[model samples]
Target chain A: MSSITSAKANVLVVGSGGVGTMAAFALEKGGKASVTAVLRSNFAAVQQSGFDIKSLDHGDIQAWRPSAIRNSVPNTATDATAQPYDFIVVTTKNIADIAPSVAEIIAPAVSPGHTAIALVQNGLNIERPLIAAFPSNPIISGVSFIGATEEKPGTIRHDDHDVLLVGAFANPNIAPQASAAAAKIFSDMYGSCPGIDVIYEPDVRFTRWRKLLYNASFNSVATILRMDTSRMRISEHVIDDLIRPVMLEIRATAAAAGVELPMELVDRMITVDTFEAFFKPSMCQDIEKGNYIEFENIVGEPLREAERLGVHTPALKVIYGLLKGLQWQRMEAKGLVKIPLVSEPGMKYGSKPRVVT
Target chain B: MSSITSAKANVLVVGSGGVGTMAAFALEKGGKASVTAVLRSNFAAVQQSGFDIKSLDHGDIQAWRPSAIRNSVPNTATDATAQPYDFIVVTTKNIADIAPSVAEIIAPAVSPGHTAIALVQNGLNIERPLIAAFPSNPIISGVSFIGATEEKPGTIRHDDHDVLLVGAFANPNIAPQASAAAAKIFSDMYGSCPGIDVIYEPDVRFTRWRKLLYNASFNSVATILRMDTSRMRISEHVIDDLIRPVMLEIRATAAAAGVELPMELVDRMITVDTFEAFFKPSMCQDIEKGNYIEFENIVGEPLREAERLGVHTPALKVIYGLLKGLQWQRMEAKGLVKIPLVSEPGMKYGSKPRVVT
Candidate 1:
């Protein structure tokens, strides 16, 4: 057995879905880290079969296994072999579920002085919860431009884009150099992997808002309409009337939050080459499968931020209401919440109740 | 041979679906009018079996047949027996279908000086087309507050209420007495029918705007979400966020059109009885069945009018865009329209196009 070495990094990836698995592969490919992934469901199959990534950039990866795979966060009190990881990568869809919070999911593997948390998820205002939960640990915010889906169990079909933008959280309490150093380490690890390009951003908030320019518009609209980006991008009316307006609202909201997203970003979002590649956004996929959407983190938080900033975002407000209503409807259908009754009384014609028995 | 008498009024009901059949039955029930109906697709079934109205107020009418039922308007030039009718009731859904316009549908049966047009539809700005078509004919605008559905062919399930508000169009060219006389005659004929109450309003524009308060809000929201009024009315958040804002925009638009719809009407629309009766608006039903919606008359006209009048209606604009996008998407799916390609070129990463074959 090899002794523990300070040069090699130990990484723990939580929520081994498509993005999680991709991160794991990228980390292991760097050859400087031992990666472990924690999966919720399909743990047995993934542990036994490993991962299959059919990438448009890289050739098909038949069965790429990580150093270790576990179903849940190892109980540090029970497992003697478990050790604190230097980096914890999170990649779950930010929906409200019975699973543990991001903080709780990484608690067992985090060491205060050494561990850094990387969030590879969609939407805005997501870093707040992590920041609130862990004040001292370095936080890295990652926005992925890859299109991936896990239609088949234990396999990921990655589309043409596999780019990631990562930046350290601008926390006044934490040293900037320390956070930047941690982010660079992650970027180097992820960038060394084939077919993956990781860029270091100085301002993660700006990057997040830039990514939200697409997510806030295309993701929600596609999910709501049950259509793909190809279908949506085909209509000039949709781009001009629906998508552009939503992007403008997000831009305005970001401006209120002290970030000025360039207008060219909107143009780039609508005119992107891969827009007609028949990519169904992850939110749309979740909705198609009757699964819960990451509505709160993606739409709700941004809308709330807009409201708090006293900026009127009519398009975002409308989208949020629609998505919230749909989420509530799903919950009601599943007996998770009680359907509220109509508050008004029955009709009365000429002072007599119009009742039919 | 029957004697030609002015005492026997001649009426033609076009598009004999649920609303059209109900009007035919009510007109025939008055015993003062000889009613003829124009059936479109179900001409054979309706002409052979007649209509079946299952009502909560009046007992079920097993088979109610009009005096004459024809598949199309009779060729007045060829058939000497055909006579111009005194009234033509237009009840087909006001969608932008590939079929003939409403004016053209009733043209073969309309007499320029004598036949008054009754529009029993759910929308705003519908009378403009009729006015443009017939410059001198008296136009009667009617709003029906009845719940009816055609669950089976040739049958209408009428709910507890069957109330109609009718008035002469506020046309400057037409004499008020002439339009009022025709409207009064139609109202008396309809009111005489048991279980149906018809009210004659002098201010027809006010009535229309009042009815639109409910239609523009509940109808559009229901169609956009593919949800019924019962489900929508249950959530106060939906009302506060979506429904009420839409109504307020409609109210503002009406104000810009020199009509002030009272806020109390907005309250009544939300709090009215029978709102929670699982009543799916006609637009919602149209969407579920993959049929075209009355977007122009219901949403587009109002939005355009608001723009013309220089009033801001942001919520309505967003909703209109979404509905229009969905409409175009449906058309594309049905091969009615071509899907446009993405206009931008592929991405270039560091002086090389990122191409994957």
Candidate 2:
């Protein structure tokens, strides 16, 4: 164990948002890993001045840089001298439709039989693409519950909670016992620090569904309604009529997917997790900032699973539709896609009036 | 029949919106009724200059007014010598939570046993209040489909369609045969003009549900999404996933209420009625203008019926909850209702950090 702790593993964190930065901070502070973060938009500023983090757990952290920083991932063909990464942790928003998918983004550093791909992300059925892309690699899946936001580039404001459930996704190419061993190694290194709470989950799918009970209902509903947690909870009959029904639909869908989330989880999410006044969910914040939402990974993929399992989810269907509409509107505004105008009828009415009242 | 046509009925039209003004215009144009219009906000402008009417059916008219105009509805106690109206046509917006209810607005002109109350409104179970108030009076309920808008104080723009389904509500106090006769009399007078296609529906509850199949689904969905008909329809999977599911819920609810609206009506409403480009539904318009929406009559009352009948309507319930949230937001913005701010927890986290990474 001391020899294992003595040799620091190289971990690469892709998509350095609030979650990514915090994970990097925790991993490096653990002293069990040498962390390199790829900062796309804030590469220059962060390299120049480092991060200024005001966190509930870490208190005030000023002008702190990770062990290493890279603007772009190294291409193996172009740079033959690039070192192999022990783990490539992805912390980006799980939007499946964007160009150069997350799997492709982390392809170069993903060393087969060596690099364990750890996904620190939100959503359901998110491990499929990575698993499909790198069949030989063991995928470390995580469901993180953290209150962290990048107020600006290299500026983070994290709230109190920071809990994560980690497990190995079942991979056809890799042995099941080997995958579990890989996940244990990754989680041990990740939780080596004082601030991060990482629990090893044998069945991460169950854990994923457990987290989705709150996310699929409150997050989506609050975003669509344009209300904060406080406002949504305080609104009359909103919980009983809308949010609770959505949660029940999710619970049913989870059951169909071979997971039984307790009905009590719904009550805990509504009453305990949403106890914060005016706390905006990430999706709500994304919408207000005119950023692209993760409808496909969070709601769409799960809805497809529900459909495959023959579960009826009318509430989820409507929520999915509305989110799609909103995201399309945003895309159109950003000139990402041009929606054609509907063909107008030549005349609004018949040639002659039926009656002249 | 000739005597009935020749007799000039005394008609008082309350709530002089586009629907009310057009009803008044049509009744007077028929040469069978002396129309007295009660105009609230536009009373001064309309009384001073009359209406500048540009209609698709009626063509253009410079200045037009009903036979008589009054600023306010007469109060029986205050105006003891007020004339008793033969029929009071209520065409106002059916907002149930307002101070002066639609039933009370025309209470003074409602002559028991003699005057018939014609509700040219859009909603379900709207006749209940009036039925409760004037038990002996005939309740002439109408489901109107007209494209008319009051652009300004004294300007009107009328589209081509002008169809109405007229029927009488079943009143316990009045004989059924007498109620039918009263509905016939009112319909004849109202549709006397050449442009109005008035269909007498013996089962008006069926018609109300039929109309609600569109209003409760498309209208409410469009408003919540902040998208017009074109935008909503053109979005991918919206009609199939969101709008159609809502219509199915309404259809099931209608079936539970003993009204078998055909499955084909959903197709008709989606394809034909929504053919027009950028057509904003009335509820969407009401939300844009910050007016109180008719959620209670259009979606709320029907949802209540579904609940009472033990029919599950998850889609409708969600739509109802959202509309309620939006309206409450609007009300709070207008300082109508003060929503108390939630008590903030003193501290966000526990005493000590579990881990500080």
- Using TM-score, give the best candidate's number: 1
Best by lDDT: 2
| lDDT tens digits, residue span A260-293, model 1 | 9988777767655355466777788888888888
Candidate 2 lDDT over A1-357, as tens digits, reads: 101223788788998988999999989988888988999988998999999999887789999899989999875446765567878889998778666788888988877677888998888878889888888888989888887888889999888567888899888887888788878988888888787788998889988887787788778877887887666666646677777888888899999888988777776667554343567788888899888888788788888988999999878877888888788888778888765554444522212222221
What docking grade applies to model 2?
acceptable
Estimated TM-score for each candidate: 0.92, 0.90
Residue lDDT tens for model 1, B329-351: 76876788875454344422111
What are the runs in model 2 whose C-alpha is more than 4 Å off?
A1-6, A274-276, A344-357, B1-7, B97-100, B274-276, B308-312, B344-357
Scanning candidate 2 chain B in windows of ten residues, the lowest lDDT window is B348-357
Is model 1 an incorrect, acceptable, medium or high docking prediction? Answer: acceptable
As a whole number from 0 to 100, the lDDT of residue A52 in candidate 2 is 91
What's model 1's TM-score? 0.92
Cα displacement (Å) at residue B146, model 1: 1.8
